[model samples]
Target chain A: MPTINVTLYGDIAQYGSGKQLATLDLDLPQDANIGLLLERIRLPSEERGYLFVNSVLHDVPGLNASHNDPLKDGDHVGIFSISHMWPYQYRQGIHLSDTLKAALEEKGVMKNTYRE
Target chain B: MARKILRIKMDDLSYKYEEVPSKWAKWGGRGLTSNIVAEEVDPTCHPLGPNNKLVIAPGWVSGTPAAPSSGRTSFGGKSPLTGGIKESNSGGTSSQKIAKLGLAAIILEGMPKDSKWYVLVITKDGVKFEEANDLLGKGMYEVDEILWKKYPNKPAIIGIGMVGEKKLSNAGISVNDPENKPGRYAGRGGLGAVMGARGVKAIVVDDTGGPGVEIANMDLFKTGRKKLTDAITSHDLTKPGGGLNSYGTNVLMNIINEAGGLPTRNFSAGYFEGASKISGEMIAETVEKRGGGMTGHGCHTGCIIKCSNIYPDEDGNDLVSPVEYETAMSLGSNCGIDDLDYIAKMTYQCDDLGLDTIEAGNTIAVYMDSGALEFGDKEGALSLFDEIRQMTPLGRILGQGVKATAEAFGVFRVPTIKGQSMPAYEPRAIKGIGVTYATTPMGADHTAGYTIAPEIAGVGGKVDPLSDEGKSELSLTFQAATAFIDSTGYCLFIAFPILDIPEGWAGMAESVAGVTGQSITGDDVISIGKEILKVERDFNTRAGFTAADDRPPEFMRYEKLPPHNEVWTVSDKALDEVFAWVNS
Candidate 1:
């Protein structure tokens, strides 16, 4: 088993420590991925707005590409509620995970919002 | 009822109306102001001298009901702070009123021979100047209250405070919001000092019974308006209860901190531990608990995206209308202060004193780095406002802005480009914005080109924020696009939806076409934006700006910011390429 540091923000924090912002450490199986971590915390994938793995963007609401990427030990993950936004202008040239980068390239143009 | 220009000769205390010249008929807002300043004012004249002129204009669709968030007003002049051409715009009722009154622009020129301060009252009939002896030395809040009582019609008032009267380099022009709060501001580039130099304290615009804006093509306007309204209402980041409407612009505090680009502690660190305390989420939560405070507040009428908020004190009294993200970062995290209440008070004081919040906060931070005041000294920070009011020598030095304060105190780690302080973002961590700060003629303005959309949010396209590759092109593209948006009278927040939604961008062009009765396309809009940049850059060149002027401070290249621990690595060749197209 490995432990991962997770931080949740906005409305989604209720799924973790029941506060607006909460940081918790969770123990998971050896081959655990982001999907497993989400399931363990009972946070649905649909409710997440932005996801960052060690400050590298991995998921946006409309585009989720890192769900199956294996999580390493001591990894830090940040989850944001859909109500939270990071405009592109402010983050231009920010680092992106390979998974999200590939997905964005395949999709060609970036879309604004993602809804069920 | 045709649109006309109102020229006020402050030296003679007289005014005249002139028909819109054929060449300038198509220009509005920043486009018109920059063009007027470039054509009429001498480039080498002292920014606050008699030879300098202040030009004010609204966007083409400013007064029309069909254009949402299209009531922004632009003020243009040679900047005393940057010593370059500058256009600073703000959202308020004045733009719509000026447009409705059938005025294309207002030009204030010449220095008054008399020492008496005057207030200009503009109505449908003409302009009248009255001595403002009683309003002298008063903060903008008291001045707004007095003027509202004097004018029963509740006209839009644009005024300055003691800082402007003293002609401080950081002084900004204050515009009254819908609530009659003098918080809305064209608060950049020290334009208020120019207005002050002309011996004018305020300008009141009353549009009662005035001929409204003439729409050349009503059907096209309506079509474009509907498309844009649909895009705005549907966007998750802008609609009601969306990110902006729910928490306001201060929402960036947490995310930027998480991304290791928050510019904490005078740009020495990138992450601020106290970011969440003064974030948009905390602000909204406090506003909900406090009865008198409100979220989703509008700065002006006809704005669909109400990202503004009214923060309340502990006793349920209104403290400040909005505590913007830039202010929170510059005054809060960057200065090592985490108390939200204190930041709000500082914001209100800055607004009332007619000082540019970004410049004022950065100056204080530089002063702190100079060992005058310890970081996060709330009481000492608050007392500086009184020092400024009392006209202390030390206060005057701080009021001159970051570069001056740094030079005065012998602080070598100054964060400025072209004599203006950098905004909230750390250039060492975000290389693209560094490119923008170095290359923009406006001198380190975030709004000059916001590449954060693609770099952080993945809106238009994704880019690696840490990489220096392609940043020059990214900055060039954004700077041109932003220049166009600044001229539309529409709020820059619209960039979010328009960039993501193709129809929204088209609607913007169509709306302008409908107003001016000239067909336009997306390419034409970008071309106009580039043209505006060219005119501004040319003026700066004539004012003695060189390639050396277009760069970040040397400290940024040597000193690495924390968390990411990155220094500015963008090549100088790439920076010069940003404006190389202008000469081409």
Candidate 2:
């Protein structure tokens, strides 16, 4: 049972206290994806924002995997809500979750687009 | 409304109105100031001497409903602090007033031979030189109150405090906000010292019955302005209840601390344990409880974002309007103090004294490093404000800025570049902004190119904040974008939405085109930004700045910031390549 210590920020803190790291001890499978972790935290699947695995902004510069992407065991994931992504529409052409993309359009937040 | 240049010759106290030169016709704000200083003022001239000219200009969009946050004014001169070309821009009512007065640029050249201080008042009628001797040695608050009472018609005042009058390098020019508080400061690079050298206490502009900004294409202006407004209101970071709007810019306290790069205790550590106490959430909650305080306060008119906030005391009396993120972090976390009340008090002192809060915090932190007091001695820090007022030898040294203080005490670990102190962001943990801090001609000033937006906050796109890869290009791109944005007189906060939204970016360029009828494309704005950078860099080059000058402090490269434990690893070769794309 590999546990991921997840920290939530801004509006995402509503899902957890954020005072302490939410110990996610779901004991999920090896190389479990970020969606599974987000589901465990009870954060909505449609929530659009940034997820940093460790100190890096996820999926930006083709450096790391994004929210919909896979997470390695013992990874520390930090979530920033969609409001944080406003200025950069998911830096460096990231492929967001379908639910997030749909929600962005539905909320009239943006076109769920990325600048090349 | 035709634009004119108002030149005040301090040598004989004569003023002249000249036609805006053809080359300077398209430029305004930072663009005009840098161009004039680079072309006319000698770079090697003494920054506080007669040869140095203090150029003040409003952004092109000022006095026009072009963008939500476009009332920024630019103060440019040879920096007495950085010893390089400097442009310090701030948002206040003054820029709009200056623009409405039909002046493209108000330039003060030549130093006075006598020591008498005067106030230069501009109106639709003419310029009046009144004896400001009575107001001499007074703080900006009293000075502003005196000037406002005398004018009574709500004229915009650009004045300096007692620190500036003493010609200290850390002194900053204070501008009156809409509430008549002399809080909005064009604070950096000792331009206030240059203004002090001119022996002018204040420049009061009464824009009543004056011609406003001339828009060439009303239809295009409307269309472009709507696009920008829509983007600003629609974006989550800038919209109502968004991060900046709800919590103010200090909102970054928690996020940046979590990212492990908040620059605590003079850049020794990347995280502050008490960051949450001084975080934006705490500030907002306090504001809610305090009756006198208010959030979503705009510093200038036409600002839709309203990132500024009014901080009140326990009794709900106004302490400071807009206790900014930089001031809070520099005074709070960097000094190891967690209390917001103490931070607000320090901020109020800095404002009243007309000192740059960032420099004051940095100097105090360096003083702590010398073992004069403990790291979190709030009282010790507060007491230094009194010393500054009294002008003790130690206070005078600290008033000169962080570089001078460190040099005076022979203290190492002085976190400054180009004689200017670092802002809130610690460079060791955040490498991209570190690159920007080192490379930008404006010294360690973060607003020069806020790569923190994309690198940390995901504005343009998240580049790894801790990594050096793809940073030179990112920094260069941001520097070019920011230079142009600063010229337009838009608040740097707008970069968040504009970076992510193409419509927002396009609309900004279009708005400029509509106002000036210049047919400016998005690409042309980039060129304009690059041109501005070239002018600044050329001036710095002639001013004796070199590649060696373009670097973070020696300790930053060697010392590893804790929690992150990351040393600044950006190579010189990469940093040297930052300006390569400026021409192309």
Candidate 3:
């Protein structure tokens, strides 16, 4: 078995302690699927809303983790609990391009951005 | 009232009859009017011009014995708010009573000469226009009082206040309730300005204790009414009269604030620390404690959910009209005044003077940010409305719109989309609402495509509020469904439960079928809504407004709201998809 370090950003941090960052260590068989991670910690979000590492709505059924696609190390993850938080989780890719990031950094808003 | 429209051209005050379209029979009430306006009215024309037609419709289940279904009506036009299309519905005896008079949509055209005020009276007897000046420049409440004394024994009245009298951009049309009070307003969109420009001061419809609506199949209507009313009474949103009925819209202050997207002090921040003091709970307590009125007032007859109320000052004086979540957030939070009483006074001033809450709120936000008025300053804010009434330079720019205000003050982040002002929700946060504000043809309206039903009320499949993927599709679906529901003239609040039961819309439509001597279905309902969208779309295209006007402010994508620290990440390219219905 190999242990993988998983980091949570955006709403997932708020779910645990309202922080902007969190990390969890999970032990699984080699090349485990991404679904196994959410199954390990079923978010107790009473809001009945969720976000995936890839910023999807996490609409998968059941907690079974082996069915999903495999994940690699250093991949960014996010979880959202509020029903309206869906737009924010998926936007890290749209405006966070390298050039855009540089521009945002120059503008000073790129600081405190969620990162691993 | 079935299969009819009281098509009145104001040019010579002449009238004609038009048979109700088959698609419209299922989508009764405001829903019908909105559809007609969208299809026929040119969006780019002057909202007060003859090119703009008003569609006044009763609900599919309206003009019946269904509790809370009898007293509603919707007014549709190309809005002065967002410079798009609008169908603002209100509750009063007018819709129910007018439908009883067998008039469907009241299409008014040709601007009347100045110094003239006309009243359109619809009764079982006939439709006639009577010059109305005894009611000119009167407050809404006062207008209702005079009309009530003139026509007793159940007559409905709709009027324009002083704001409309001036044809200000932030005017609203008012209607009287069962109590003969002009508390009900065709509130948003500055349609009242359109009415004011026509020199129409008040409308009186006397049922005269006359026979009510011509019920086609009474048995079917009764059965459907029982079920629909029960559903309304049973739902948590409508139960305990739900949030809207219990505390009116004030319930939203805490809800939006807790979400941390209330847009305090002109979008400077999201949270208002003094929110609880101006909350619905506080209003309820204050009214009950001070021997003042606090309970919600029904906008129309047969409404199980009474989401309207007339809030009074501490001395038991009517300070303003009923203040809601949007008004509170706009004037209270957005303007940074946490005082409920002050908010109530401001609310009363707008209603009595006939101003749109969204515009007033937007004006306050602009003033606070420009240092013309300090944040949380109630006195200064109240004086601003007075200045607008006086037609000051600041008032003129503020009256034109939020965009105008920003330009006059030279502020970058004006928080307006199109030419219209943004409501309570802060863009760059509240992603679902931001999507709604961005794409709705009505322009930055929270009510145009209310995502709160799903986002906050836990209504259907969970659509991620923050995600932009599939959001265009999501907003399109919601706005379409909403357009259908709105055309029906049924209260949009009923949507809380209607979303759960697929049959709910059909059942309501079935009652409409029984009344109209026509048959309709849920599928027909969607088509009608789609057709309505196309109509509004074509109107805009004719008026030279392109797809470019649909996106939110540029700052929305960059500025991250606090607490959430999120900006609107959705791309304009994605936003263009929401309007794909235009091409289709």
The candidate that wins on DockQ is: 1
**Winner by TM-score between candidate 3 and candidate 1:** 1
Worst 10 residues of 1 chain B by lDDT: B451-460
Query: Which of the CAPRI classes, incorrect, acceptable, medium or high, describes model 1?
Result: acceptable
TM-scores of chain B, in order: 0.97, 0.97, 0.91
Comparing 2 and 3 on DockQ, the stronger one: 2
For model 3, the stretches where C-alpha displacement exceeds 4 angstroms are: A1-116, B16-27, B38-44, B67-70, B113-115, B209-211, B316-318, B450-468, B501-506, B517-525
lDDT of each: 0.85, 0.79, 0.64
For candidate 2 chain B, which ten residues in a row score worst on lDDT? Answer: B451-460
Worst lDDT 10-window in candidate 2 chain A:
A86-95
Q: Write the per-residue lDDT of candidate 3 for residues A1-116, one digit (tens) a residue.
A: 65655434323444445343345666766776555656665654332222333322222112222236565654434333222221121121221223333333343211111211
Q: Kindly report the docking quality category of candidate 2.
A: incorrect
Candidate 1 residues lying further than 4 Å off, grouped into runs, are: A1-3, A17-19, A29-32, A68-75, A110-116, B451-468
- At residue B103, give the lDDT of candidate 2: 87
Candidate 3 yields a Cα-based lDDT of 0.64
Ranked by lDDT, the better of candidates 1 and 3 is 1
